[model samples]
Target: MKFLTHTSIAFILLLFASTSYSARIKDIASIQGVRSNQLVGYGLVVGLPGTGEKSSKFTEQAFSTMLRNFGVNIPIGEKLKIKNVAPVAVTAELKAFAKRGQKIDITVSAIGEAKSLRGGELLQTFLKGVDGKIYAIAQGSVVVGGLGAEGADGSKVMINTPTVGRIANGAMVEKEVISPFSQGDTITFNLYESDFTTAKRMADTINNLVGANTATMLDATSVQVLAPRNISQRVSYLSTLENLEFEPARGAAKVIVNSRTGTIVIGQDVKLLPTAITHGGISVTISENKTVDQPNAFAGGKTQVTNNSTITITNEDSRMFTFDTGVSLNDLVRAVNEVGLAPGDLMAILEALKQAGALQGELIII
Candidate 1:
């Protein structure tokens, strides 16, 4: 089968210029101090159907510790047959401004050599933050989305991950991490993507809405805006401010190429200088045939096999094309389609242009 060229299989996205569009401040930026915190803890899962760890020291020690806390002690050097319990690591994300007694979801993952946690129940575990302070307590029946089965002949089949599970609203917040949002005189809005033009435009937009000097552009990422010191008024003020719409700067010129999938995307702003390029490929084909040689009747001669091979080579006609100075993306695509170049050839041409300083944009290959 003949391979398809770029003109046949490649996807070209051409973004044409249109009317200016605006985006809401909340869609492009976020409050600096409003973010989620990661919390983790070590615990155990119980009530497994004989799929738990059998000889893990940590699992046994954790089991022993729990029993000791319950006013029971195990005799020294006595191995416990606790195959119903498995040690696990519990994790949860504590969102900002989470109040005490609020329920949050938690994930339980086995840390030992347990076969599965399909029907396990996580014990009470204290989830802590980076500062080593307990933030929430987790305890619930695990819900596993995976299934596992083992045969007596040492064959096993599994889907998803049986050793990991999640419990919805299983953890209750026990502490609150203080935030500086209500304590500061000014609030900062940080852009998700840093751009000096976007930052300046945001400041200008705010100043136009709430009068001069209301917002200040600090850098490429942050825009500090003056607000009421009172928490209630500040909340209302930010609510109004974040919903305002304004035009942000366009992204920089870039060309992205997926090497594995042969997908090439050229940004609208990408420009090309005056340059000439030519591309072609050579195709080689080979074939073989076999035949048998038989002796005549009563001749007593042995039969032998004969083989024949044939090879053919074909070369594509190379074509040279020129791009004028300050060429747009549309022109580049039109020329490539007219020449019927494949995606691989186009990628090579783009890289060569970049090396020769003819491409006026960034080229990224993934």
Candidate 2:
């Protein structure tokens, strides 16, 4: 038993040690100007089994336009009863430096009152960027993550979202987006989360790996690194820089409370000042009793209705506790748990502590 216990303890410690180490630069920051662009377009979905939108003027107009493009013209004011088709808005993210003819995935969402998008195929659509320039053409069968079925009695069952679907590798790039990666002798790295300590540490690590004065911290969110003037050498330099690993600085102490879900999260650096706390609850209950008042048999009075009401208030006994100076997060959690407080009560207590200057951390309620 002793041996097994010792082995278990060692395994847990090893796991923690492995996860507490430094992270790679590539995982913490991204090179500036190397990001994806959003593209969107209006399209139509077909092949739905009577589940498509009905009486949609936009869908009808779009269908007419498509037919006219195919050299089939319909008369003016002609209404088409196309219940198997739906108008959809298609969107995709064009990755940086995507070459022409590269295939990308696209998302199609119903723009009408469609019942479901299952078993639908998106027609050929031109996806455009924010500049109104056509970037790619998307067309393929959609794969919906949800399904639905309705009975003749108006009862329906659904799973997930039925109005949205995806098409893997449905868009083929028609144009290439130019990047300025090789234009300058320096490249900037933007941190995912802006922090002065993290920015400084990253700069120092890069400087130590490459050379002195090779990297500089521009601000809490950006770090500039000198690179080779040659494009080939710059690629190699960035590859090496991204693989470097270093420990990041700890973040500020904070407590996050979710009011709707009654969830509370405390940071490791959270501390409590020397203070005393007491917790209790008050409950008010109101009850009503209905009865009938009857007159005596010989009296000529009619029976009357009456109501009896009662109100009660109860206050629970509170327990008092004190915390030493610089109480750790674990100690605070343990003490609170020992008092058997719910998350809602814990939120109230934390707010009170913050107001009284007893909490040494920022309290954020969402």
Top candidate (lDDT): 1
Assess the local accuracy of residue 250 in candidate 1 as a C-alpha lDDT between 0 and 100.
82
> How high is the lDDT of residue 51 in model 2?
84
lDDT of each: 0.90, 0.88
The digit string of per-residue lDDT tens for model 2 on 1-366 reads: 333343344334534543557989999999999989999999999999998989877788899999999999999988898789999999999999999999999999998989898999999999999899999999999999988888999999999989999999999999888888888889999999899999999999999888999999999999999998899999998999999999987778888988997767777778899999999968999999999999999999999889999999999988888999999775776677567677777799999999999999899999
lDDT tens per residue, model 1, 152-262:
999999999999999999999999999889977899999999999999999999999999999998999999999999999999999999999998898899989899988
TM-score per prediction, in order, is 0.87, 0.88
* RMSD value for candidate 1: 4.3
What ranges in model 1 sit over 4 Å off? 1-19, 283-312
Predicted structure 2: clash tally? 0
Error of 1 at 205 (Å): 0.6
The C-alpha stretches of model 2 lying farther than 4 A from their native spots are 1-20, 282-317
